[model samples]
Structures are given as C-alpha cells and as structure tokens.
Target: MERISRKAAEARVLDLDGREHPLRSLWASRAAVLLFVRHFGCREQAVRLYREKGTIRALGAELVIIGNTVPCFARAFREDLAITTPIYVDPSMASYRLLDIRRLREALLSGGALKHKLSALCGGFRRVQTRLDRSQLGGVLVVRQDGAVVYRHLSEGADDHPAIEEILAALAPRTSDEAQASL
Candidate 1:
C-alpha cells in the first residue's frame, strides 16, 4: 500500500462513470472532495451514508468515492439512496491500496499481536474500530491548480477525522480573486 504524501503530485482517478477524471482538472476547474469508501460492498449503503450526511451540497465539492466493491452493486445502492454525487467504482482496489486503506475488518482483527484469550476479547473492539475507520476512509485531499495539496487530513485511526465544514473551508479559495480567477 502506497501512502499519499502531502507533497505528492496530483493524480487522476476514475469516476463511477469510469471517466479518467483528473484531480488537477478539478482543482483548475472547480473544488472537489474525494471521498474514499473502504469495503464498500453495497452502493445503497454508500448512497445512504452520503445522503444522510448531506455530503453533496454541504461540502460543495465534487464527490469522488473509491472502493473495492462491485460497480453494479454500488450503482444500485446509490440509486436507491438517491445519491447526487458522481460515484466512482474502484473494482481493482487500486485506489484503496494507493491510499493504504484497510480493505477488511478481519485483516486487522487477527493480525495484531495478542494472547489467544486477549485476541478473542479484543476482536470485538477491533471490529468496532475498523468500522469507524472505514467510515473515515480516504484522506480528504484539497489541492490547488498547480497540483499542491493545500490541505490534507490523514487519519491514524478511525475516530479522528476532518469535519465536512473543514474540508469545505480547505476547498474554499484562499482569496476572492483566486476564487474568481478559477472561474
């Protein structure tokens, strides 16, 4: 799994529509919010999650979801939830691996060092942490037209995360001129 450094060059990711959507293009053209959903097995869940959170209009950034689930399932789920954000299907787990997101809760559960009895007792705890972390998967990367990561929120665990408002603020142009200039 590759860690995306704050200084790394911007890369393009495919939309759920499978278009070669470039991050630079979005920065140059408009502000974008890349949402990484790990173990996104159902699109309905994705849609409900986003919709319930009001992610689309609240963030005012392009919604880009990356996950290791079937696109068809995601699509159906999104449709059921009435997600307006453009969804992207990362069937290959390329984005997940690139972002270094854990794909399975069980992977983290049994792999940790612990006594046999302790492991079993901690399994439930690990599962909860994994779910929480998965909910916060994908670092929210705010970039500029020149491909600079102006702001980044990389999580060390599941609970610590950047708020939607903070992400919107990061996506906001630094100056009025800068904001207008992009348009």
Candidate 2:
C-alpha cells in the first residue's frame, strides 16, 4: 500500500460538534482504522467495526467512523448504535473523492448488497431512513502515524468492507525491511 495522498489527508471533515478537522489528525498520534461509511443510516458496516473497537485498540490503533452526512445524522447514528468510537461527517464527500472511493449506480441492487442487507437484518440492526446518496459506497483504510496507508479496501457496493482479519494484519507490527518493501 502507498502513503495517503496529501489531498485526502488534508481533507476536512466535521466532528459531531460541527467543528472542521483534517483527516490526518486521526492517525497523527497513533495508527488508525478509518471507516468511510456509505451514510449515517448504514449501520451494518458501522456496527461491525464498532464491535471490534477493543481489538483494534489492542493493536495500538484507533477506529474512526466517517459518514457522508451532516452532524445531526452522525449524532443520531452514534446514539442509535450506542457506540463510543468517534464519528465524523463529510457532507461534501471531498475525502471520498480524494481517496478514490467511487459510487456505483448498480450497487443498491447488487447481489452482494442484498446479502449484506439480509445479514444486517438478521443481526438485529434495523435500516434507518437516510436522504444521502444511496449509490455511494464506503471503504476501509489502515494508516500509520507517519501517513503511510498500510491497507486500503475500496467498496464495490453498499455494505462491502474489508475483513477484520485483513485490517488487523495491516496494523500488526512489521519489520523495517518488510515495511520498506511494502512502500
């Protein structure tokens, strides 16, 4: 994986309080697992990452959830999910564009999307109403403090995300040579 682009790292997102903050701050102090969510109402991916927050932190990384909506929607998502992981909003979706996470019109009707919806329903997470773009997908990025993005998974459809094991492996310590070679 390559280091995060300066444009993406510098893209501004709003916290729940509506304050603008750069995305790089997320990994400045520690490695971070950044989950760019489809929307605030898509709880499937968010809940999955939330469940693994402890394991992620155990690897000396923080998990940050970013949604494409306003602060109110993000606040509601946090309350609805009852999770402590920091959630942010990018109403303009500039970060998504900079990261090359695209939107597919067929994503909503894809077989994988259907399977994910069913799985979320069976898991007891109800679908909430959202006005945000339904075609927009989400992605995962594992980034080190120095700005190297060790792992990146760009979603092909709604609810598509990288495996927990894959993300954890990216966060796992690597020897200097291994790290250098990956770069």
**Winner by TM-score:** 2
Candidate 2 residue lDDT tens string, 1-183: 588899889999999999999999989999999999888878877777788899999999999999888999888888887989888999999999999988977637678878878888898978899768777789999999999888899998776678888998988888999878976
Estimate, for each residue in 42-88, the C-alpha lDDT of model 1 and write its tens digit: 23223433653454445445555554455565565466556666665
lDDT of 1 at 133: 29
Worst 10 residues of 1 by lDDT: 125-134
User: What are the clashing pairs of model 1?
Assistant: 16-87, 16-88, 43-74, 43-77, 44-77
Candidate 2 has its poorest 10 consecutive residues by lDDT at 104-113
Top candidate (lDDT): 2
Runs in model 2 with CA error above 4 Å?
180-183
Q: Using Cα atoms with residue i matched to residue i, what is each candidate's TM-score against the true structure?
A: 0.54, 0.93
